[model samples]
Target: MGKVMLARRAAIAALLAMRRDDLFVVTGLGSTTWDVASLGESERDFYLWGAMGGAAMIGLGLALAQPRRRILVVTGDGEMLMGLGSLATIGIQRPKNLAIVVFDNGVYGETGMQPSHTQAGVDLLAVAAACGIGARLDVSDAQELHALAERLAHFGETLFARVHIAADDPPRVLPTRDGVALKRRFRRAIGIAS
Candidate 1:
């Protein structure tokens, strides 16, 4: 059989379908941010607008601060490549509640679809494994995606996955752009008074 390339929106929808109330999400800028917004906005979602390579670090901080809640970072391959060092830091910190999912379409979706390192044969899952992330996965089909989605809710260790998605641009679904409002809402969602 030929390789299976998952659709970005469908993959994201499945992953979020089973999201629990305590799941905290940090979305990288561009496509990933759009994907999360498409699923429907929530106070638990922290959408990054300008921090190009900081999603994982933001997730790490959130994971550290709210140890009881599950932290998920969804980012595109370009963003993940930019913040590659964050993986090493996360590996060292070993936050059991943290998981990172990269939608690797092998291109910079926001930047005119230029081929990315993943397209050049860079394996992010391997890098994550090298950084000591124990639960590393490369999802290329629907069944694997479903299993990965299920694992998101109950993951016990720091996990990372690179999901191969189609390189098609979908309609952009935007969330609130006000930084203060987002911070306030997220803080309030986690039980912190603004």
Candidate 2:
């Protein structure tokens, strides 16, 4: 198969643009974090700087705790691969308001651009399906991405998608690194006692 046509920044911008006020976003470390912060910081956005493989689990926790709000977990293929078991856990938990979107550029963009398993033919969509996530998608074009964007707006089921983006690195857009402050801000935004 030929390579995917989507650009990482464009895809992320499109996705975040569709986010509603109640949407809770958790981004994985490295490129995905940068991609999210690039759209401007938000109290609803929790950017992971160190927990390399825990984004989805954190999203799951938030989804369970705040069942009424939509939760979106955005991460890169490399990070997702490191925490592959989270998929099965999420599949079992099956939060109706949770969605996970993987930016699969087929490389570990932060670690010297090493080729990832996605580049070696590991299909994440298939894994999600096998893990029992009912709503799974593999996005490679603008139309499909738009469709995914729409679904994210009114999410009602556990959703997973691996978006194939270009391998080129974009300028980093870093968020605040203070975990305590981020936690307090996120709690306040969600109306929880910090």
lDDT of each: 0.92, 0.93
How would you encode candidate 1's per-residue C-alpha lDDT over 22-44 as one tens digit per residue?
Answer: 89999998899999999999999
Instruction: Give the Cα RMSD of candidate 2.
Output: 1.0
RMSD of each: 1.1, 1.0
Output the TM-score of candidate 2. Answer: 0.97
Clashes of each: 0, 0
Candidate 2 ranges with C-alpha deviation above 4 Å: 1-4
**Candidate 2 lDDT tens digits, 1-194:** 47557889999988777778989999999899999999999999999998999999999999999999999999999999999999999999999999999999989999889999999999999999999999988889998999999999887999999898999899899999999999999999999974
Error of 2 at 21 (Å): 0.4
TM-score of 1: 0.97
